[model samples]
Structures are given as C-alpha cells and as structure tokens.
Target chain A: MSTDSDAVTAAVLVIGDEILSGRTKDKNIGTIADYLTAIGIDLREVRIVPDVAEAIVEAVNQLRARHTYLFTTGGIGPTHDDITADCVAEAFGVGIDVDPRARAMLLERHKPEDLNAARLRMARIPDGAALIPNPISKAPGFHIGNVFVMAGVPAIMQAMLDQIGPGLARGAAMLSETIEARGLPEGTYAGRLGEIAGRHPGVSVGSYPSMTQTGFQNRIVVRSKDAAALGAARAEIEALVAELSA
Target chain B: MSTDSDAVTAAVLVIGDEILSGRTKDKNIGTIADYLTAIGIDLREVRIVPDVAEAIVEAVNQLRARHTYLFTTGGIGPTHDDITADCVAEAFGVGIDVDPRARAMLLERHKPEDLNAARLRMARIPDGAALIPNPISKAPGFHIGNVFVMAGVPAIMQAMLDQIGPGLARGAAMLSETIEARGLPEGTYAGRLGEIAGRHPGVSVGSYPSMTQTGFQNRIVVRSKDAAALGAARAEIEALVAELSA
Candidate 1:
C-alpha cells in the first residue's frame, strides 16, 4: 500500500564525463526536475555518472530498483564512448541488438547508404524494451523495465520527457509557501524558526540565506501537502520575522 | 607517479533529502566544481545520498578510499536530520565528541549561555579530524582522512571551500579552448569533431548544443593539461568548423 497520495516517483541518472569535468553546464537536470514536478511525478534522486560502463550499470540497477521510474540522459550517441544502452542491457541481464523499430526511426533521417556502423549504434536496443519517440531526432529512446534511456542533448532529452511524462503515474502536488525576510541574518532567526518548525511536524520550514545589494536576506520556505497547516506555519514564521525585525 | 602535471582531483558527496525531493536547488556542487577547477583540482565524480546512516557511511568510506580528496556538502546542521559528522566518524572507525577546536570556533559567536543542545550539535567532530574554519557562522567544518565535511548552505560551503582550497593538492590546470559554431547542428559536426578528438589523444573535446533567440549553436570545447597540445587541437578544430560552415 502506498503511503503517499502523489506517489509517482522517478530518479535521473545523468551519464557523461563532460559534466564531471565541468566543461558542460547541466541544463538537463533542471529541465527534467521542472517537467517532472509539473506533471506531479516526484523526482526522488539524480546521479551524474561518468562514461564508465561499470558505473553506469551499477547506477542503473540501484536507481531502477529503488524508484518506480528511472530516466537516464546521455551516452546514447553514435560515438565509442556512448555505451549507456549496452551497459543498461547488461544491468538487466538482457541481450542488446539493432532493433528494427529503432532502425525504422533512424532510416527516416538517413539514406541506407549513409547509415554506417557508427550511425547504426544509435539503433541498438535491449530485449523487451519499448521505444520512446524522439521528435527532434529519428533515433528513439528505449525503455526496459522501469528505466527509460534518452539522449544526452538537453533539447532531445526534454522532447523525450515531454512524450513520456504524460504516460507515468503521478503523486499529489507538493505545495510551498515562501516568506521573504527583508534584511536579517539566518543566525538571528534560526532559534525561533527551529522552534516553530519543531512545533509544526507536518510542515518543513527551510531558511535560505541570500546576499542582496542591501545586505543579507533569509527566505523561509514552508512546505506541506496540507494547505491549512502550511498557512498556519507561514503566519507564525511571518509574525516571528516581524517580531525579530522590530 | 602522477601522469599529468598540475592534476588536482576531488570527489563530492552531497548529503541531503532536500535535494532528492527537489525541494532545494543544489548550489554547492557548481560552486565547488568552479572553485576546485580554479585551484587546479579536477572534480572527478559527485554523489548525492540521503542522510541515511548506512548510505552516508558507505559513500564516505568508498569516496575517501578512492579519491585524492573527498568534499562532502550537507548533513552538517543543527537539525535532527544533520548526522554527517557522526556518520563520518563511524566510517573512519573513530570516536566522536564535541571537540574543543570546533566548540572554540562556535563559542566565539555563541555565548556560553546560548549554547543549547541543538547548537552544541555543530561542535561534534571525529577524533583525529582537523577543523575546517567556517567564516560565515563560525561552526567549523572538519577534515577526517581525505574527507572534508562541509555545510549544505551554498554561501557557508563556499566560505569553507575558500579557506580549504589553497591547501589541497593541485594537479595541472585543466585548460579549455572554445570554438563556437553558428547554426551548426551537433550531428553535422559530430563525426569530424570525433576525428579531431581521436587525433589529439591527450585532449578531450565536447560538443555543447545551445539554443539562441535566433536559432541553435554548437560550442566545441577542447580541454587538455598541455596548453600547446590544446592550442594545436583548437586550431585544427577552428579549421574544421570553417570548412563545415563553407
């Protein structure tokens, strides 16, 4: 029995050395997070793994085992380093081959003459895996068990997510209420804030210290599924902020 | 026997449920990556685990064992959820207590009377660990073996990194040269780029596709420890991009 009302859960495994090297700013994670949150499927975890086969296999097995759905971005290219599909297949103990369905998708873009060995690498799919259509590129993403393997490119990954997001089971929307502190150090507010947070067990209150041109500002965020409880906590927080400022 | 000159390496383990729940946007990873890169340390891998004792212990042990330095952000706070110091102590098989050094640091800001049970939580450190000075809240970070436990808050974590960055072992700076392609699809340049990358065995080239207001652009980045090799590879890449555009 599911304890959570909005129980659809997912984890993202971002596979690439480019990101680890910091040469690439990861836009995919933020994009996926926003998309999943909007669709009501809670994104539980995100892991950035290198191009290593062993790492990919281990992360795939672990995340897939834990979450209801797993979305993997990157390492599905035609290059030699693109080994995500093969590793994912190996993780599930399945044989990988150039699937006709995947080939058909790619065939639309390239002439049969132009489809070389490297290009054909994109068409490889694990057994019993279903294809998730990529609108931008003809090469489709494949799903085996709970894991959906998509391209590393942000645009294409987003496109694939847009296609798949609608089909997944989603949980209740996690609500948030934010109270902006004008000019206060987080330390000054920490004590009373902790007391309020402790008193309200259902709501989670987080103090974010941000630097402004004026000075330091703390943004207190109250999050809960219950709106009434959230409102009550927010009022207390706002009152405390006022009291502290005075 | 380090292969490359100026080779700096770090592995980051982010401990928090806030990140997993997508409640908090992780600012520490990018900040640490940028800081470490600037200091000549290549951040090789990053892991985000929840505040679970088993997970924290396992990640800390594994990362510290493999990497030159392991920087952990999060799970060091006043809340009940904050358990990184204890877990880290357990991982190292060391006894933990409210260490004098850490308490001294915190006592500077907090009055002896103001130091409650919750506040005292920040002073706990494993035996044999060195204090990592925190410039923000004065709650000191600790270093156990090669693992540096830091705060989850971006600014505080950044402050700790600033204090610690200069002291760490640094590798040769990972230099990068960017070659921008206007309106070039990554697929169009993918093959030749791969060829160029293969030719320059020491250099790593990544193709980043970005969408502009006008259209799409692909930014090719060539990174290498050897500046001369990077320049040579970059020239070849520029020539290829010019040829492709023509």
Candidate 2:
C-alpha cells in the first residue's frame, strides 16, 4: 500500500578485525548512518563483523535480507585478509573472479608491469554485480542484489558512496528539531515529556541528558518524516521545558 | 572445558534513537570495545537499536544468547524514553519495579525531597540484579544474568564499566604488537603477508595501509592471547618487511 511515509531502509556491515580488536575506532558507521539518513533511507542496523569468512558471510546474508538495502565496507583491498569480495560471493551463492571492469579501474592507477598478484586482488568482483567507481583509488567496489560492497578505507568508501548515492531510490526526508533545557534535570520533566510524546504520537521524541562541567543539561530531540508534525512536537516540548522552568 | 584460550566475549547494545538517526555518533560502543578487549573479553557484535521497546528487548535477548556477555548502554535514565530496565526485565521474563537497592544508591546523591517521580525512574531495575556502582553520578547500573545495563552518557558508562570489569570473569589477555612498514604499498607485500599469516595460524596478523602526505604507509599488527606466539609472529613480520625493503 502506498503511504505518505518513504520507507527505504538500510543496514551497514563493517567487516574488520581491527575494529573488533579495539585497534581501530569505527568512523564509517556514523558516516554511513548520516549519509543514509540524509538520502531518506532508514538505517535500521549497523553490524561489525570480524575478517573471518563465516562471520562476514553470515552478516552479509542476514542484514541484506532484512533491510531494503545493505552497504558493506572494508576487506576489499589487496591483502589476503581483505576477503570481503569472496565472502559476498559465498553469501549469495555466486562465482567471483577478477572482474575486467574492476581490473580496468585498477589499471588506470598501476602500470601493467606493476599490477602484481597482490595488487590484482583488488580487481576481484562477484558475478552479476555493477562496479561503484572509486575516483581517488584505482580499486572499485561493487553492488550485487540490494547489497553494495565498498572499501574499509574511509576515503575510498566515501568516494564510492558519492558515486552511488545519486542513483539510489530515496524517500521523504526525515526532519528533526531540538529543544534545549538549560540546567534542567531530565528527571524534573521526564513525566511531562512522556505525556507530550504520547499526545504527539507520530513524532519520536527523545530526552538526552549531558553532564556538563556546570551541571546536567537536557536536550529533547523530536524527529519525524513529517516536518509539520516534528515542528508541532518541538513546540510542545519547548512549552513543557518553559513550564518546568517556571 | 575452559582452557588457556581466551573465551570471554561481549556484545554492546546501544539503545537510543539519537544514534540511529545519526544525531549522536555513538562513543560508548568504542569505549566498551576497548575496555572489553583490554580485559581479555573479545567484543564481537555491536548493535545499535532505537529507543523502541521491542527493539531493545529483541537485541538484549539475541546478543546475550550469542556472546558470552552482553553490555547495553543507554535508556536507563529518568525519562519515559528510558525503558532499558523495563525492556530488560521483559526480555528475561521477570517483573521490574523501583529496586530498593538502586533507590538506596540514588539516595546517596539526591535528597529524599528532591527525589521526584521522574528522578526516581532511574531506580527501576529488573527482579534480581547486582547493582553496578556509578561513582560519577549516584544512578547505579545493574547486572542481571550476563547483561550489564548502564547509562548512555559516556562518562557515567565508563565509570560503571570500571566498577564491573574487575568482578567479571577474565580470560587470557589478548595482546598485540604493531610493526610499521615505511612507504610500503600493501600490493607489494600483501601476498607475502598472507603467507606469513597462514604459517603462524595462531596469531592474527593484519596489514593496514594508510595514505599520508608522503606516500602509502603500511602497518602490520599481530595479535594473540599467547605472548610467545605473538612475539614469534611479530618477528616473522619484521623479517618479511626487511626482506621486502631489500
């Protein structure tokens, strides 16, 4: 049934042992999250699996099946540990080889003599997939079914996203408004906030308390796909905060 | 059944709409990841779910069953949106209310008169749980089975983690050593590195390439619970990099 809401959804699968080992702090999850939200896609889940084939395969299959789209980053490099392309193939029951399109992309950067076996690893792509160009690097990412695989490298991954973002289906943009409560404890106004949220059921209102150097400051963020509804809820929240102050 | 193998594993459930909407970049997931890894607990899957009760309940149930332990951050606050404790109880099929032990901890920071209905919401805990001391603020976290629920606030979450880390079961420490390869492209050394990784088998060695202003610099990181195995792998990696230079 066609409804007012745009329902394009996505999940991010970050494949890396570095993240799980605490050697790397994930910057890609938030990057992808912000990008998806901006493009009117609901990013429902973000999962980080290790470099292990089973872990990668299982996550790729699970996330792709549940969401409208799945985006994976990392493990598509030249290293042996970079096995995301192979894993994607196994997950979808497809064959994988050095894709000519991907190879051509790599050849743009490296001379024929320089394209060693290790370097050529970046050219492998799963069958029946379209290449997502990486302008900065010669390596290319690919998309098969609803899943798009990109590099773990942030710069390369971002370039790939820029290439693909314009082509994806988008829904109505989700809008958000924030109301600040200066020096107000959430506990002081939580009950009323709940009531306000219930009254404006369409908008999802959240209360976040940050313990600043001065004291606990509260910020209520109201979000919805409908801008008018979000504004109405924000107004109610502002009124509630003002009343609590008095 | 429990040998020298480091078996302690953990998953983090970030409960908030702020994160999913990309309003707040999750700082707790990485914080917990570092903490768990440092203490010999392998932090596996990390999940970010909205403040929706069903999402929280499902994540808590699923992650706890899969990992050796599950740590959930956020929603254990004073607001109506703060339903982690309630959802946790529902997940475990137990009744929840304002726990006396948790109330006593809150009383340490708040005067009885100031303990308003909203403020007291922080005292709600599942039927049976050991209170996790929160030194930063008086709101105590709780341990119900393998799940530890804490505040979403980074500072307070860190405090709660510190309180509980020592009490939990720890396995052999997962140690790592890093060796840098100056200006070495992964393509030049990926195949050999893969061979070295295969030979070691015990320690996990990963080759990461970072693009700096100078050129592409690679770092090989070797990790294992066994110190001797890790050292040996590190030596092999160092030798390989030296040979590549030659």
Candidate 3:
C-alpha cells in the first residue's frame, strides 16, 4: 500500500557520446541524485544514452512518461552532435524553433553581431516549453511537460537545477541512518538483517561492502520515510551489529 | 551502415538503491566505461536502477537483449538487498542454486564453518553460467548468457573486470584525438566543426565545453576506427581552431 500521496519521483537521462565513449566522466547524475534526494524527490532511475537522435528521443519519451520529472543533461550545445533539443521536440511531437525569449537570454552573453547560426541553435526550444534560465552561459535550458533539458557542462546544469529546484513538487523525505560494520563482514549479520527488514516492511535495509587494506569494511544503511520505523530499524540493526562485533 | 563487422557493444546495468539514493556516488560506471572504450567494446547504454527485483530483472532482460554484452555491477554481496543473482536468473528463466565452483572459490578465503547461509548466497549461480573469479575477495561473480555480474565494491569490481577482460570479443579499436580550443568559445568554432563532421562520415566529432576558473575551456574530440578519417578530421579541426585563434 502506498503511504504517501505526494510521492514525487524523477528520472535522469544523460545524453552524450562523450560520456558513453568515456571521454567525459559524468558528474551531473550524482549531483542531481543528491539534490533530488535532499529535496524529497525520489530519483527512481537514470539512463545514459548517446548523442544519436533515436536513442535520445526514445530515452526522453520513456523517462518523461514514467516519472513525475525527467532531467536531461548534454547535447544542447552548438555542434552537429548536439541534437538533444531536436530529439526532445521529436519525442514530444512538437515544432521547435528559435524562441525570442531564449535569444534575449543569449543576448546578455553574446553581442548582437556575434550571434551566428551555430550560436542561434542554442536558442531553439520546443513549442509550449518554459525556459529554465542559465545564469552562467545565458544559453537557456527548457522544461517541456515533465522533461527538463539542460546543458552538459556541470556548472550550467547545476545552475539550471537550482533555478528549477524551488518549483518541483516534493515527496516524503527519506530518512536514513548508516551503521559502520567495518570489521564485521556482511555474512555475519545478513540473515538477521534480512529477517529484521522483512518484519518492518516500511524500512529498507542495505549492506554495502568496501575493501580496506585489512579486509572488507562493511556498512548497513537503514532508510524509511517514517521516522518511527526508521529509528526502530536502526536501533535493531545497531544492536545486531554490536552483538556480532562482540 | 555498419563500418566494422567486429563492433562489439555493451550495456551496463548498475543495480543499487544506494546509487539512486545518492548515498553512494558511482565510480564503477565510469571505470567500466573507460575500460570498455579501451578494449574496443563500445559502451552503448547504461541504466542505474534500485534494489527492487522487478526493476533489476526488467533492465537485465532489456539490456542483455539489446547489446552484444551486458555487464552488471552491485547487488551481489552477501546481504539482504543483494538480489542481483536471483534477478539475473529470473531474467534468463533459469534455475539458481549454490554452485560448487563458486563455493570452492569462496573456500579459498572463507573457512568451511564461516560459510554460513548468508555467505552461501554469494555462491548462488544460475544453471549453465560460468563463474567469474573475484581475486580481491573469493566470492565469485557469475556470467550467465551475455550478462557478467560483478560486485559493487570498486576494488573487487576492478579485479573481476581484470579477470574477465581478456576474453570479451573486441571491435576495431576507436582511435581519438583531442584538440584543445581553450581560449576559443564553442559558438565561434561549432559551425566549422559541424562541417568537418559532415564531410567525414566515418568520424565522430564532439565539442566539449567545461568551465575553468577564468572562462570556458573547450575541447574538440574526433574519433573513428579508421585511422585515416580520424587523422583527417583531427587535422581539419585543428586548422579551424588555429584559424579562429588567430
């Protein structure tokens, strides 16, 4: 049964051949993930697709349809490979052109004489979309329906996310407590942890194992939207971990 | 039209609620991406989903069906939320049980008495699957069909990747040249870059703009399996950038 009516969820679609080709390591996904979680928006899924129009379009359509908000980064630059805007327009079945509003935003950064055709490509926004202002580059990102098209550059994307952050509908904030089971291997307490998790359906328990110089430094993270359930599970888990350690 | 008959592509399925929840920043995706690119296997698509079984199974099925190979990281540890093994089995419609091979591998690190039920979970492999050895920790990751399941831990995952790297079918290695146009803005050189890309059908050109402390530090990357095309495009891009710099 659903506990909250205001369970806003989001998905991120990272569109770039640079990322897939490993020329660029993506920082936006994690940045957005952390931001959304802080704002009580559940980031359900993330998909990274190449600059190819078909891939971008398919991913955008699917993600936007499924989640309350779909944030996309990359491919809005003024290059041949930067086709995210066009792909998004095609996905939404809308006409796209140079919006005067976006051009005005660009005017702040570029002189009127310097606005070449390639520069003008950044002004192209789908029909009926609201512009998400870029404070850094003045090349505006846009929000059409549930989808937000942002710049690939981390700074610009962060700026756009900050602009849109205030307006998003939020869900119940997920509260989590992490217990370090550094010397305690997951196998030692996993069965009991599972049993505890089953008993408290509202809580989610995860065991993460990281390698240290000595051996495995494991951690158990308990999360729930309900503070009472979260606290109870945390207490039980902490006790279990303590018993195992002793 | 396909240029290389040996074009082996891969999709990465990162299974973790910790990643989506932003408690963990994913280092594995980028590591795998860089490795795949170096090995000539085009990292096509990547999807990061939560620990939910249905989501994991659906993503595994979809990614494995589409790409030449699907490499999954996370959810294979001995914990309550570690269900990637079962999900992969369900996705492939196969029976799963503790494989003797995997247990034997685990026996190298874990004592016979220490190999409890929770520890035995690591040994669970789908029928007809081959065990991918984990050199760091003896818990083995399995490769059933085209999907190679590995641990979420960076060190362990890297070891598993190293173990399996030599056997993967590789495509023609993509050669790339990066031309730094740090001072020149993207808008100034984007048109010429687009033109160069259009003329060279075999090459893939990308303009990446990153913000420096002073301003935008941009780079143009030209990539192709054909060395001649890659060279030509790189030369043209360099000329264009040089001319613009003047």
Candidate 4:
C-alpha cells in the first residue's frame, strides 16, 4: 500500500518460468523500481510467478487489489506459455482479441506476409485496454485498469516504460541523501544511529554494507519527501558518523 | 504454495531500503533461487520490504505461514536500521538476546575489547534459533522454525547457506534441459509447442528469447524432477526446433 496520501504505490508481477527456475536473473524489478521511484511511485512488492495462467491471474488480482498500480513483465510473447494477456483479461473479467492498432504497429516492422499466426500473437490485446507502444519491438504492451503488461526483455520493457512515463499519475517524490561512514563498521555507531532514527520519524534510515576492492564499505541513507526534514536527518547522521569515526 | 506433495516450497523476504530505492541491486535473490532450486525447493514468492519493524514483522509472519521455508536477506547488521533480528523475534513471539556462542563467533574476528555495543548487535538472536555460521564476516545468521535470517552481503549469505545446506530438508531435485530454436520467433512454433507441453503432464515447457549479434534467438526449456519425462519432453522440443528451422 502507498504509505502517505501523496504516495503512489506499485507492485511488479514478473511472469516467466525462466525466472522461477533461476535460468534468468530478473533485471526488470530493479530497473522498474528505479524508474517508478524517480516518478514518485513507491514500489511496494515484487512477485515472480511462472508462465502459468492461473498463477498469473491470481497474482494480478491479488496485487492490483492492494496497490495503486501493478506492472507485469514476461509471458506476453508468442510462445504457448505466453499467457499473460489472456490471464490478465480473465482477472478483469474482459474478453481479448487481436487489436487492429497493435496489428498495425507490428506491420511497421514486419511485412504483411511476415505477419504470420505466430507473429500476430503479439497483437492480441485485452478488451478495453490501451496500447503501450514498444519502440524497439513492434509488439505493443497494454494498460488495462491499473495493470500494465509489458514485454520481459529488458530493452523492450524499458522502451515501453519511456513511452508510458509521461502519462503516469506520479506522487510527491521521495528525496534521499547518503553519507558514507568511511572505515567505520556498522557496529561502531549502530546503537546511537537507532536512537537518531527514533528521533526523526519523518525520515527512514538504513545502513548498508558492501564489499569493495579494498575492504568493506558502509553507507547510511536518510529518505523522506520533505527536503528540509531530510536535510536535518542527513546532517544528524553525518554528525553521528563523524562522532563515531573520531 | 507448493503444487505437489513432494515439492518443498519457499518464499524470500528481502528487507532493506537500498533495494527498494534501487541504490543497491540485489544479487541475493537470484543466488538463493538457484541454490534452492538445485536443492529441490520451489521458491514460490518473493517480497521486498523496508527496514520498518512493522513491515518486516508483517511480511515474515505472512510468508512463514504460507511456505515451507522462508529465507530473508538484509537488516542483520550492527546498525540501528539493522533490526531484522528483533523483528523476527517479534514475529515468532520469542525473546532475543546476545548468545554466548554467537559472541564467541564474533570474537574470532574482533578483539574482546573491540566487541563494542554496535558489533555486539550481531549476536542477538531469537530464542530457540540455531546459528548459521558466516565464515567470511563472522556475523552468524540464524535458523528458527521455518525461517532463516541471513546477511545482505552476497558473499556472507552464500557462505552461511553453504554452512547450513546439509541440515536442510530437501525434496527430489528438479532437473532441466534447454533446446535452442535458431532463427525462429516464439509465435512460429508456439501453438505446436503448447500441444507438446500438454502431452507431457510431468514436465514444464518454457520459451525464452534473447537478442544476439544476428537477431532474436529463442530457447525452449523442459523441466521436471522425473529424468525420463524431462528427457522425453526435451527430445520433443529439439525436434520441434529442428522442424521450425527447416
């Protein structure tokens, strides 16, 4: 759910057996999370379901009910297992057919003879859904209700996102500031850091550790929609890190 | 939920703000999915929650109840935001404290005088949980009930999993084979591919597309625990791809 009234929340439903079986490492979740955050939509949850219709339909219905928007990737291809469009239609209780507009979009890349039955599978759209144009691939994605069904391939999904970006209903952007705690391990400053977080309810604080060529690095981040409040929290965290480092 | 009685199911709870804000790309999910699949656990769902205690507690309780095993990554550090241990304790209605064994584990890396309050935070574990040793960092993960709380660092998490691997309850391994369908769009063979997949009740068939130097390359994968069934399905797909290529 969206945390604040001004926050637009979203959930990603990645549909593919390749992902569940670990044959494919999903790049879309991180990519879409970054994109949505830029436009003030909080990515609340991400679920990866196999290329099964019942699984896709169940996930779509459940996620769409809880979030402001649901974005699905994969399973919209021309393969037998590519059942996302049909499943989405069933979820919304709508009929689906090959849209002339989507077929026309495909024709931009493929010749009339090349638009065989297999290729035409990309043109099917759920009834009452608008097309999300794919610039890289002619196969268009679609937006029905709060669900946006996009291709699984990272390049095509990105292009579709760029196409639909301007039309999205964005909320207040969450501003974030990061402070590196240089060589200090998290344990050195963790106690007071929690107290500092407790003092600032407006901001969310987190500490992350990463391995680098030299050694480990810890970063503390403060995030909030309020710039002034975020600034105050950032300053406090910086001070805390300084005190501990000294 | 696990589809078959013989299948062991799991859910991943990724807790961190770095992932949600897209500051850090999570490598743990793919690593764990591949690991679990190899060991015969079906990862049914994945949820990424923030550092908030309520969010962690809610997700932990919900997922732990739904799946046979729950693996959590992130928030087990020496910082205040690293409250996963506490949240996990709350989820299970248990008391938590710094166990002597865990402190001893930390002492292997840190001098006794250096084990300050912050570093000691890593030692606090829920009641009745067994430590999952971390060889890289010496910060131990814990397994309690059906839940495993692990580090966010990929290296440490992997090491901990290696340490705890032998103790896990494993089902029959799910095996897979891939067939390359050269120079074909998924739609060209999708209809017949579905028919073949329907014929094989024991195996799952999936089509995946990738962009290469030439153009689009498609691969069909057949997966199942039964080797003979998987072999039969794989043979059928290879034949289909050859026919389509011809």
| Candidate number with greatest DockQ | 3
Better of 2 and 3 by lDDT: 3
User: Taking the tens digit of each residue's C-alpha lDDT, what string does model 1 give over B104-144?
Assistant: 88889888977766777889999999999988778889898
User: Per-prediction DockQ scores?
Assistant: 0.32, 0.59, 0.71, 0.59
List TM-scores for all candidates, in order.
0.84, 0.96, 0.98, 0.94
- Per residue, candidate 2 scores C-alpha lDDT tens digits across A1-246 of 012344998889988888877788888888888898898888888888888888889989988998889999999889888999999999999999988888888899999988989888899889999999888777989999999999887888888998889989998787877899978887788888888888887788888888889977888888788878888888888888888799
Candidate 2 residue A42 Cα shift, in angstroms, is: 1.3
- The native-contact fraction of candidate 4 is 0.68
Interface C-alpha root-mean-square deviation, candidates in order: 4.1, 3.2, 1.9, 2.5
What does candidate 3's lDDT look like per residue over B1-246, in tens digits? Answer: 123556899999999999998989999999999999998899989999998889999999999998899999999988778999999999999999999999999899889999999999999999999999888888999898899999999988999999889999988888888999997999998888889888999998888888989999999888899999889889998889889999
How badly does each model clash, as a count of residue pairs?
11, 1, 0, 1
- The CA lDDT of each predicted structure is 0.80, 0.85, 0.90, 0.86
- Worst lDDT run of 10 residues, candidate 2 chain B, spans B1-10
Off by over 4 Å in 4: A1-3, A111-117, B1-3
C-alpha lDDT (0 to 100) for residue A234 of candidate 3: 90
* Candidate 1 lDDT over residue span A1-246, tens digit each: 012644778888988877776666777777787777666676766788877788899989989998889999998877556789999999999999999999989889888877767678889999999999888768889888989999887888888988887778777766777898867656566767888887888776776555556655667778776789889999999999898788
The CA-based lDDT of model 4 is what?
0.86
TM-score of 1: 0.84
Candidate that beats the other on DockQ, 1 or 3, i.e. the better one? 3
lDDT: worst 10-residue window of model 1 chain B: B1-10
Question: What ordering of candidates by lDDT runs from best to worst?
Answer: 3, 4, 2, 1
lDDT of 2: 0.85
